[model samples]
Target: MKKAITKRLATIILAFMILTLCLNYVLQVHNARNDMYLDAKNKFWQINQILKQNEKETEQVKEDLKANCLIRAKAAAYILQYRPEITEDQEEMEKIARLLQVDEFHLFDKEGTLYAGSEPKYFGLNFTSGEQMQFFLPMLKDRELELCQDITPNTAEQKLMQYAAVWREDGEGIVQIGLEPDRVLESMKKNELSYIFSLVTADSGTTIYAIDPGTYQILGCTDGELAGKSITDVGVDPGTKMNQGFSARVNGEDSYCVFTDGDSVILGITESNRGLYKDVNSNCLLTAVYLVLISIIMIVSISKYMDYYVVRGISSVNQRLEKITKGNLDTKVEVETTPEFKELSGRINLMVDSLLDTTNKLTKILEAARVPIGVYEYNKDMKRVMATGRVADILMLTEEEARELLLDHVLFEKKLEDIRLHPVTGGKDVYRLPGEREHFIRMNTFSNANSILGIIIDVTEDMVEKQHIEKERDIDLLTGLYSRRAFYRKMEELFKAPEELGHAVILMADADNLKKVNDDYGHENGDRYLQGIAVILRSCKAEKQVLARISGDEFVVFLYQCRDREVLSAHIRELLLTMKGSTVELSNSKEIPVRFSVGCAYYPEDGRDYRELLSLSDHNMYQSKRNRER
Candidate 1:
């Protein structure tokens, strides 16, 4: 492990060092070539300045020759008009040309034909004979026009010469003179770029060129082989770019090239890359040696530190983890050599301790929850019910049976089927086994996605309390009989079996002396008298009898399943005789006989509306009370 870590770290260090070296090498090479490129560009600019100056000097010399040529032509024209004898005298014109230091002279008549000149060669040449002589044609009509032309070949001999012409002073004819242009030729020779190229100095492998801007023609070159050739033939393209440097093969050798434009020339230079970066490569080689030595020292130092700190600390951590994974959770990680490792160790310990704490809390909670409350979850895919231990106890299963049920969902459902749905007190349903004294379990089930989750709670106490509350709601507290609402509900249920309602009677009885008893002997005696009437109503009951103390002093009896209406009336008469026998002993130990005003309404004979039958019975009860009072 230590070797792997160290090897990986060393690989990273070497990669970074190599990357740095490559970047440094590239930067140095760029700077070296840039220095040479800038120098060549500067030199091109110097060559342009020299070419411009030469152009200005050449222009001044050409202007001097133009004036000299015009002055000589005017002198010869003055002579031709004054000395008319020389009009056709070749010898005299020749002598006149010699006197003016000119090369030739000519005379044209008004017809615009050349009649004579110093070098006539028989002399019948017209002004239209050559392009050079056409300039004086316009002078024939305007004698005031004087013209001097640039140096060119004459029409007769095609010898290079400068010519100027004017009409004879008297308009007799035109006189023209020609000169050799010796001074202008001499000035241009000195201004030639070839002469300048010879004077340029540069390092070895560098070349200088002067090219014609219009033709891309190489006018001059320091390497003489390129002279007088098109720039393209020498692998140089004199493009529109100026005063910029670029890299290319020039003369089939890799070179740095720069170009600039002069007045009438393209000044350019090329330098070899070999000499450009020589010192840069040698310096980089030395730097690489030093970097290698430094890298070796750094690797050794880092490896030693790894052996002591990182490797040892991680080994201890791994050992503790191995023990914990094997169930020795008491093992603690305590490596503290470095802050990073120390934090890692503390986190591992805390995580293990948290695992144990969570397990303990869950155990205690499961133990506490299983007795009174249990959970059973089932999904179709699961083979067994996931349940609490209390579920088995609630189902009255032994340990072995519970285990079988937990392992097999089919067995669990079969066990559930064996439990009976029994009717408990107060009309609520509870679940138990088919045996006496079995604990009641309330089933609250939630179902979704073909799965049922039943929360089983031992609600024995809750059911008992609920029954007590229901009894209070449905029973009269004073007389322990059904209240008015319960009595009516039972009557409605009884009427659902209409065949049994044929002989049924609804009897309403009022204690005739209850008000008097309450007034003379306080309300305690009134309550006892009413309770005695409830007893009498309960005494003579038929198979389907319902008794209720409905109000302060009224008791109701529903006697059904009798032989006929007459038998129902006989049942009521027996109830009245019981009421007469029934009496209450008051708080004062005074005895009061329970006398009741009894009235009956027969069902169906009184038309089956409970309120109507109850109304008729109450009316009959008041009539009986009136009769007793009389």
Candidate 2:
């Protein structure tokens, strides 16, 4: 009976081992294939995202160019309207040229003849030969307000022709203002690659402009030689025929050429797919090795027990042991064995049973103990926050002092506002807990019909460490004020607030002749001068205002709740005078007075918002410097 039992146990162990090996092999193969497929899919998605981002950037560049063109056109129109007498004057032409930053500025008569221009050669000349003339004559006849046409003056000279109608006080004949194409396209081409750009005439199948420098072997054309060929004539599949604006390969190995115009297509061919399998293969090998090691460990552990313990034990005892392993603690081993072995096995079984019962009890206790949890309440639309925990807390507080203290905290409203999105549960928030300085406060959000849950955890240490790192990041080592990056970030946040109703006054002040100061004072004194200026600006600003030393000698102050333009101007002048009184003592024991150029701009009056206001303020500051030089 013992031998038969031993044979039966051995056969069972052998069969189990074989089954485990087979299952492990199948699982590993499946996992490897799945990983490879997922890796490929991720790579494909990454490429798609990159392409989308590039496309977005390109569109933005185009929009910027269009906006710039409109501005230049409007400026030209303004010059002609306000200064009609200077329309035929050379000095006035130079002024307009300088103001517009154009190479050439021209005034055309009703008869398509140039009346006055920056170029002496164009004076008293007719512009009726090139493609620009073809686009210009029709506009003059139709009395068009503005027109942008592309023209190739010669085989080597291609220009963008911008012309806007200039109506005089009487509104009789059109005075056309023209700018060179190079001035507009120059800056754009410097940043955006022109090789991927193609200009095609909309009505005709004519390639007006093509910048592809490489030979198109697939289309049987050489560089600079594919200008006149029809897009369909090339090997590229017609996007119009496919009824899609853009198309890419299914394998994502290649991107399809884009037909931006009816007449031409722009092909942006990317690099070849090499080393594509490297990451997938590496991951597969590593995972396979890990699985094999784990399987070996599991097999050895199972084999050891089967040979030395379970096989030698009686059938009833072995059955009880299996039940115990499966978490059945009620079943007790009945067969008697040697005293030492029996004691050891019996103790282990009892201990496991006790642990199981204790685990269940603890789980129930934890479930019951969970309390004081709150969730965000949203309106019917679910996008806007109707009420939150912080709001509820404020309402609950009968005393105004208690509410005021909590409201004064930096993250008070922001934390609650963030919870409105129910982002904490989705791994969005990192906060610090009260009274637990070392611990961090973490919250996870859960949502149902009426409210959203914020599962809060203590995360104090994390918040403190993060604040320390942020302070280190924002503070400049040299001047000890906020760095340029910090200033920009703060400005972005300030301007982004929709509730900011007050007129924002921005003052840009720069130390006069900083380079000369640096050269004469050996940089050490220059450093002192910069620090002195930073201190003056910081001291001059009110408590609510933001002061930042943006550059080596430049300081930016954002006056949040200033009275009016005149009041803000007076404040700036006063600050400048105050700065003038302050002095920096150099190494030579000589006092150097601070000199600065101040320029200010107001929101909604000087410009629309922060970006435009900053630009206008910067322009005004430079203008002030120029005036001082004069």
C-alpha local distance difference test of each model: 0.77, 0.56
Which segments of candidate 1 are over 4 A away from where they belong? 1-363, 369-371, 377-385, 420-434, 444-454
463-547 per-residue lDDT for model 1 (tens digits) = 6677788789899998999998888888788777787666777888877867788889999778888777767777786777888
- lDDT digits (tens) for residues 1-630 of candidate 2: 555655665666566656765676567545544543454334334434444565666556555544555566567767677677776578777887788875556666667676776666766655465554555566456654555543234211344444444433344444444445554454344323232332211111112222232332223122345555544344444434332223333123432322221122233221112222334445556656665676566556655655655446666676777766553444676444567657767786677667556435544554476533323333222233322233333223345633442333323346455434433232346532233234344455566775444444434445567779989899988778788899889888877873573656888888887788799988998988888887787776454578878877788888776555666676677787888688889999998887888788887687767778778888889899999999
Leading candidate by lDDT: 1
Number of clashing residue pairs in every model?
A: 0, 13
Error of 1 at 165 (Å): 99
TM-score of each: 0.40, 0.37
Weakest lDDT window of 10 consecutive positions for candidate 2: 199-208
Distance from true position, residue 479, model 1, in Å?
0.7
